[model samples]
Target: MSDTRATTQTVRYRERLWVPWWWTLPAAVLAALIALEVNQAVSALPNWVSFVVLFGVAGAVLSWFSKVELRVVARPGGGTELWIGGAHLPTSAIARTAEVPRTAKTAALGRQLDPAAYVVHRAWVGPMVLVVLDDPDDPTPYWLISTRHPDRVLAALQD
Candidate 1:
C-alpha cells in the first residue's frame, strides 16, 4: 500500500535585521581600544588576557545587533502570519497598514505613539511598517515593525 499527502506552504517575505558589515570594523576598533586600556591598567595579568576582553566585546556587539528577524509566512491551512522576533500576528487581524518612511519615522515613534502598541523597532533599520490591528480582545492597537524592504512586506501581507 502507498499513501501520499501534499501540502503547499510559502514564505512570502523574510528579512534578518543584522548589523551592517561596516559596523564590524568599528566594533573591533572600539574593542581593541578598550583592551589596550585594560592592559595598561592591569600589569599583573598576562598580555593575552586583554585579548580575551577584545574578543568578548566584539562578539557581544555582533550578537545583540543581529537578533530581530521579520517574516511573513503563508500557511498551507490558508492564512498569512506576520512574525517579528518572538511575536506573531495573523494578517487578517490587521485593520490597516502603512509604510513609514525614514523622514516620518521619528514622528511615528514619538509622543503620539501608544504605550500598549507592539514595537519591534531597530535604530539601524530606517523604514518600518505600521500595522493597525482590529482585534478587540488584544489591547495592542498597532504594531510597528522595522523592515529593510517595507514595500515587499506590505505586498506579502496584502496577498
Candidate 2:
C-alpha cells in the first residue's frame, strides 16, 4: 500500500528543508573519491568518464536529499494533513503533537524511541515535531519529523 494520500487542494503550510551543505559536501567528496578509485581500477576508462561519474553520483545524492519537503495541508472539507516526502498522515489520526527539544530529539532518535514509531529525520535539521498516532488500526506509535520550524508544524498539526 502507498503512504501518500490522493488530494487536490491548496496546502495551508509548506516547509521545504534541503539537506545542509555540510551533509552534501561530504557526500559529493565521497562520491568523487569512489569514482576516482573505480577509474583507477579500470585504467582504460578516460579521466572525463570519472569526472562525469563523480558528478552524476554526487548530483543524484544531492538531488534526493535536497528535494525533501514537509507539508501541512488543510483539506477543503475539514481536516489537516501532514506530508513528509511521499508519506502522508491526517492530523485527525494524530493523538498528540509536540515541539521536541534538541536533547529529546537526540534521545528519540537514539535509545528512547519505540521500535514501532515512524521517523522522518534529517541529521542536519535540529528542531522537530513529534506526532503521536491515535489510530488503533495503525501499528505506528508516533512519527518523528525533522523540521526547521517545529512550532509552526505543531500549530498546523493542532489546527
Best by lDDT: 1
- Which pairs of residues collide in model 2? none
TM-score for model 2? 0.82
Alpha carbon lDDT at 4, candidate 1: 27
lDDT of 1: 0.88
TM-score for each model: 0.89, 0.82
Please give, for residues 1-159, the per-residue lDDT of candidate 1 as tens digits. Answer: 012211355789889998788888888888888888888999998888887878886989798888888888888789998988778899889999999999999998999899999998888899999999999999999999888899999999999
For model 2, the superposed segments whose C-alpha errors exceed 4 Å read: 1-7
State the weakest 10-residue window (summed lDDT) of model 2: 1-10
State the lDDT of candidate 2 residue by residue for 36-114, as single tens digits.
Answer: 8988899998877887878787878777877889988877678878989889999889888888877788777888889
Q: What does the lDDT come to for candidate 2?
A: 0.82
Alpha-carbon shift of residue 110 in model 1 (angstroms): 0.6
